[model samples]
Target: MNRTDLTAVVADATGLTTHQAAEAVAATLAGIARGMAEEGSVALPGFGTFERRARAARTGRNPQTGEPIEIAASVAPAFKPAAALRRQVAAGRPAEN
Candidate 1:
């Protein structure tokens, strides 16, 4: 599914209009982004934790040119799904294959 599908689901569950649901979803995502930027992490019980990770500088080969390139360090967002969510997704399937 996609954003529209998600909006529909949330709207149905919350008794909200599609537009309102979409806006609420957007606002929630924006809030999460802002929190991650400022606090480096956001934890939602039963959902997951979104956190920042620091990537060290490294040398990488250029696939096209076969030349080495220096990769600068950076901070990146990471997500670790809650155990309950993981189990829910894994039911009747492999966990993390």
Candidate 2:
């Protein structure tokens, strides 16, 4: 679901107004981003971990021309689900710690 749907769910669950829930969602997203930027990762127990993945500079092929080219180093964001989350998804049932 999108942000609006998530906001609605949060609002209903927490008895918060729509605007408050929306702000909370936005703030949570911002915090995640900030954490990623500053620390390169964030971990939530029973949920998952978000991290940075790095690729080194290297030579790569130009697919169309079959020519070799340089590929710049890069850092990318990634996520790995916790075992609990994976189990929950796989079994379609609540995950037990």
Top-TM-score structure, candidate number: 1
Reference-based lDDT, residue 84, model 2:
85
Off by more than 4 A, model 2: 94-97
Local error of candidate 2 at residue 34 (angstroms): 0.7
Q: Which portions of model 1 miss their true places by more than 4 Å?
A: 92-97
Local distance difference test scores for all models = 0.91, 0.92
Best by lDDT: 2
27 in model 2: Cα distance from truth in Å? 0.7
Tally clashes: model 1. Answer: 0
Q: Residue 47 error for model 2, in Å?
A: 0.2
Weakest lDDT window of 10 consecutive positions for candidate 1:
88-97
